[model samples]
Target: MPGWALALPIALLTLIPVAAVIGAALSPQPEVWDHLIRHVLPRVTANTALLMLLVGLGVLCVGVPLAWLTALCVFPGQRFFAWALMLPLAFPAYVLAFVQMGLFEFAGPVQSRLRDWFGSSAWFPEIRGSLWGTVLVLTMAFYPYVYLLTRNAFVTQGRRALEAARMLGESAPRAFWRVSVPMARPWIVGGLALAWMETLADFGAVAVFNYDTFTTALYKAWFDLHNLGAAAQLAALLVLLVLVMAAAEQRSQRGRSYQVASSHCQPIVLRGWHRWVAFGACALVFAASFAIPIVQLVLWSLSTWREELEPRYWDFARNTVLLAVGTAFIATTLSLVLAGVRRRHADRITAWVVRLAVIGYAVPGVVLAVGVFIPIAWLDNLLIAWLRPLGFEGFQILKGSVATMLLALSARFLAVAYHASDSAMQRITRSQEETARTLGLGSWGLLRRLYLPLLRGGLLTAFLMVMVDVMKEMPITLMTRSFGWDTLAVRVFQLTTESMWENAAVPALAIVAVGLLPVVLIFQRAERIQGA
Candidate 1:
């Protein structure tokens, strides 16, 4: 087979959108380089760097200690706290941004209660629309990326190493700092890389808090100034920022390998200050990151009126669920096939194509939208032209349909599904596949009967991950939804824009509530797997 033919589909689809963006970046009569150099770009880059750094440090602070305590200590509700801290992963940054803004806005319930308690104009803490507030919101929503990765490392680090450190006269804290953390550095960096990528990609939270970042600037350039080229240039800058972070992360993880346990090693049991301290710390972290936002959203949702609760809202709810489910299923399915195909082929063409497919996760939703639109629209027009010869009407494969949304979702989320399946496949011994083949089981039979069953959990987890992502998705949905169509994300976006906090709260909470279902399922599944 021709190499390009094998690679062309994924490569062409992926790059067409990026090419369109570059084309736009080049076409604005003259580049906006002068304006960007003088004013917007520098400030936006600085703020973006600041946000990424703060969020990175915050996650390390909360996630590392929390993971260690849970892994080593016997605290009250340790398992509960361990899982609950991850609950924030289910909450979208945008929804949390709205919740925080609603609570702390000048006229919000927090200030209102303070006014009623004291005299008018008495002191109340100013939090909303501040850098601190933005950091808190992002940390709350994105910390789970770090928390889960770190905790898994802590769990797998085993007791033998720590015991050896203790035998050598190392204190528990000293042992953890010197032995545990250094060994787990790769896992920690991987998680931090994921979190930082999310932090940079975040648009809704920073935009709502009125913090100037690259995404916000790009949006403004496109929507407000009517300059696609300027938006593309800004996007290119953001891409450069991401690439720098990626390089640093790669360097940090270089020459690190986390080998599986050589033998069963009992973990240390906790006592004294260790247990209580662990409990207190985890409780505070969980309460701030997950519990607070969920409770606040639920409270505001309850206060919403019956008349305002339109039945059409349920239709939107259904739409959101179906879209998420369909997208997750199709994306996961495609990823599994692609991952398997790449493994079997072991060729640069297939490997690079799969890599390119996964690259969509790093591309911001708005960037992905622009990339997808060009080919989809062109294909629609081509089909229309082709059908003119017959009496048949024009055909549109993707434009303005749920199909288009699903395609975008698959492209954007393929990484999550691919990684999940790939990891699970790695866990199953290669000997199994070899043995099955020796027994005269054809590749089809081997995959169908053996590999499929083992990977079911990973595939399901991937589906849930993608589904949650699709539920929280905003930018692409906003850009691509057909006229008169709406999802809960869109409703929340509209209400937030109109400054209708109460109305926004309804759908914001709805999005989080619906999004968390898969999270709950994943937790239960993980528990079962651990127990087994």
Candidate 2:
């Protein structure tokens, strides 16, 4: 089939859910909107805005200083900190939330120990399930997004700018603030935009904390209220917020360029106590973000081994692996085809279609779940009606099936696979394709003998990236999974909701272990960026 022919189906599949979302938004019930606006909308909007503000401040406070230290200064354990700081990326915010609650709740170890030392009436800070706690956990998990981008910016570009300021008699700190930071603002803002988008899309973490945000509000509207139209309207509002953020980010970046004249500039190196200070700060952030939570999880897992490591746990793991592997394979294959087609036949329509398909990544998982479910429910009804005349009464195919789950997962993660494959394809010169065509090789032959060989690394990278993301995905799986379709993520959510943090630890650890793959990849990529 021609490249465009293959892309057309993928584009249509991608757009169906989006169309459903729009349809739902347009057709909301009058009563639901009236109630939502009077009571729910204002509160949800305030909480979401406040959460975003706090998270943004928290990420900057932690991520920016660490990025500056790692990029510009020599320190004790600098090499280790460079990668270790990113290990928190392996943790989902919800997992950390449960772990922190386990360690700090009223009956948990910290408070118990405090009561042991002092009186039961003694004062201790309340840390679990609060807005501050949620902000802390989310910042720990997502600061890497800012750190990675900002560190790369500082290392590759800020050094020259900083030097120019120093030559004009500015002090070191003054030069950093006046020159290096301004030059790196674009990248820093871009990183913050990514962090905020992830924050807005998050459901599991906020849900666990019992903090009402837009994601949780959307979930409640759909599942709790059973108001699909209200859910869709909420989702539309969330999408509009995301679009505004994207536009603001673009506008902030307008008329400014951060690229340096060269990528080979030497970074600054600290000495003596300055180095130790940098080292201690990075170490503290790493310990709080990654090491501490993981250790707590391990301790909890060991205590609950008999219960958590049973056959049921294995089943959840198996289901998770199956879904993740299946989604990765299918998504990567489709990405390869779409990217290859675009490469071979570059045109405006194909480019626009590809862009439209990849936009699914920006949609929140809960919104995507609702969008996907609406169509699948409709299609299942149509199928059952057709099948009833053939004597297959009460037959249902799409709803509550792994097929629907895969469809949702593919729509959610296809952008990851596509970008990875597209990057790989761009590196393969067109002359190679010309050379293959001269040998009378057709498209399939070209793919088999040439493209596959060249794309092997990229395909695997895309697969692993998608697999890791799928393993940690929460809202989509939680909303869509059938009976007996529990994955590790869903198991974590179930246990956490029940306040069974010890039992949740096993699956949460499994998710973190799987998530480590992409974190390692990210670390390696950051190292390469700096080393360049």
Candidate 3:
């Protein structure tokens, strides 16, 4: 098939959910809007804004300094902290939220010990179900996004700027502030945009804290109020916020050139107290973000091992693995096709189609879920009605099946695989394809013989990324899963919702464990890039 012919169907399929969302948002709902505006909308907007602000500040504070330290200065444990700092990416914010809440809630160990020491009511700050607690947990879980990008920016494009500033008689710190930071602004902004989007898209963590963000509001509207239209409207609003942030990020990157004249550079070496301070700072962030939460999870899992290790645990694991594997395979395969089309038959239409197909990644999971759910439910109903005339009964394939869930996952994560494959494809010179064509190889022949072999590693990376993301994904899974189709993420949410922290620990730990594969892979890739 021709490239545009292949790309058109994928683009249309990708746009269905987005079209559903836009249609829902445009549908009339004056009463719902009134109630939301009066009772919920303002509070939700304020809380979401506050949460974003807090998370942005927290990530910058933790991620920037750590990136600078690890990328620039050689200090004690620098090599270790370089990768160790990324370990927190394995733990989702929701997992960290529950772990911290379990360990430090009013009736938990820390407060109980403090109460014993005082023998009365002592001043102990609450860490559970609070806005600040949510911010802290999310920052720790997400700062890795900022850190990884910023460190790469610093290492690759920042040295020349810093050295030039130093030669101009600026002090090291001054040079870092005025030169290095500005030079790395585009990357930092990109990372911050990602972090902020994740924060807005988050449901599990904010739900755990009862923080009432837009996502929680959307969930409540759908499940509690039984109003899918209102939920979609809220989702649209969230998408608006995300678009605004994306615009701001692009504007920040505009007119910025990150190229450096020289490719060779040396990492700065710290001395004495400066080294110790940098080392301590990195250690503190890593421990607080990764080590402590993991240890707590391990302890909780040990205590609840007998109760947690039932047949259902295995069932949940199996379901999670199946869903993740299926989603990864479908997403990666479709992404490969779209990317190949773009590479082979580059045109305005193909480019636009590919762009539209990847936009789902920017849409929040809940939004995508609602958008996907409503349309699929409609289609299922229409099919049932059409089939009933032929004596066919109970034909509900799309409503509550693995297929629906996979569609949502694919919509949300196809961009990941697409970008990976596209990058790999771009690296293959046009001469290679021309040569293949000159050798009498058609599209399929070229793909099978040349592209597949060349893109093996990229395909694996794409598959792994999508698999890990699907494993960690919660909102869409929670919203769209069929009856009794519980994955580990759903199990963890269920247990956490019921305040079964110990039981939640098992599934949560399993998620973190599985999530570590991509983190380690990414870290290794970054290490190789840095070495080069």
Candidate 4:
């Protein structure tokens, strides 16, 4: 087979969507472009950039210090705080936004209570419908990405490097700035890249809070104005932005590897106020990230009616579970296959295939959905026409069905699963596989007996991460969900859009409910893996 023969399928798969985006871009609409450039594009672009910058800085300020403390301190409750800080990842961005808006909005309980207590003349700070409010909500939801990556990087660095800096007469803080941060830069930046992508892809929260970014604008164009091409163009721009960020990050990480000797596994020691201060800092982090949002969500749910238990609510819940489960399973299976194949034959093709598949993680959900849908629709139309000659009627099941939504999700989320499996695979030495081969074990036997068992932790983590991602996923679900099939995410967005704050609380709580199980499971598994 020729090289193009192998490359053809993937190239065709990619080109179909790029072609659709190109067609949308070249839709002969100078007037639309002129209107956009003259009115909305500049404002949206500026706001988007500002939000990204603020969120990045906010996460760095709040998250990096906490990660360092957790990684290198002997604070009270440090053991618990170390894992619990990751709780923020389980809180969906939109759910956090909804809860925050409820607390801070004018008629919300916070202000209402203030007014009642203070004769309705209290000048409480305004938090909703502002750029800072958007930043606050997004940072709370996104900081975990930064924290986890940076913390892992610090832990991977072990204590030797920091101790060596100390022996050279460097103070703890100065040594940290000089050595630790620079070493952790690649991982931290990768995590920040993910955070930026999440921010770019955000719609439900930004829309609910009345902030306009490219995503919200694209959503309004597609849904309200019925302008699909405009949305596609906006999505194309977002894709370009993500690609640029990815390129920049890759360049910054030109020659880096995450490796450390086992001898440096001894933990660092914290003395005096550093210990107490670390505890206080972690307490503050928990209060802001988990305690506040959970309390607000619970309070809102209790204050609301049971209208969410209605049949329609059940349907949405059902849809949400189906989508989450389907996407998790597909993503896990595909990742396992790719991981296994790569393990068996470490060739350029296998490596590149796996890399290409996981690049979906960097692609924003909405952008990927738009990219996916265009080619799918094009193919459906082409197929329907071609099949008509064989007496088949119109058939386009993938466009507006659970299948399309799940595929889009898997494409966007396979990296989480792949990364998990990839990490676990790294822990297993090639020597083990060679030993198995010497013992007359073939590829299948080695995988079945050794690889699968060793990779269990990764598999579990991957499934949980993908499951959480699917539960909170909104953009692609909104684009491809069938008319009657509303996921909990869609319901939350719709109810919020309609100002049915109480109704939205139900689905928001449901999302929280769905997230907890996997979170607890992942934490337990992570503990065992880390301890081992």
Best by TM-score: 3
Over 4 Å off in model 1, which ranges?
A: 2-8, 23-31, 116-125, 257-274, 374-401, 423-458, 521-532
| Candidate with more favorable, higher TM-score: 3 or 4 | 3
List model 3 lDDT by residue over 194-277, tens digit each. 899999999999988878999999999999999987898898787778778878888877876767534744688889799999
> What is the alpha-carbon lDDT of model 2 when measured against the actual structure?
0.85
Return the lDDT, model 2, position 215.
Answer: 95
Write model 1 residue lDDT over 470-530, tens digit each, in one string: 8889887776667657888877877787677677777787677767776787667666544
lDDT assessment of candidate 4? 0.79
lDDT, model 3, position 76: 93
Worst 10 residues of 3 by lDDT: 256-265
Candidate 4 scores a C-alpha RMSD against the true structure in Å of 3.4
Position 5, candidate 2: lDDT: 69
How many backbone clashes can be found in candidate 4? Answer: 0
> What tens digits encode model 2's per-residue C-alpha lDDT throughout 178-271?
8777777877887798789899999999988888999999999888889878888888788778778888888877887556656544556788
Best-to-worst TM-score order: 3, 2, 4, 1
TM-score of each: 0.88, 0.96, 0.96, 0.88
Off by over 4 Å in 2: 1-6, 390-395
Question: Which scores higher on lDDT, 2 or 3?
Answer: 3
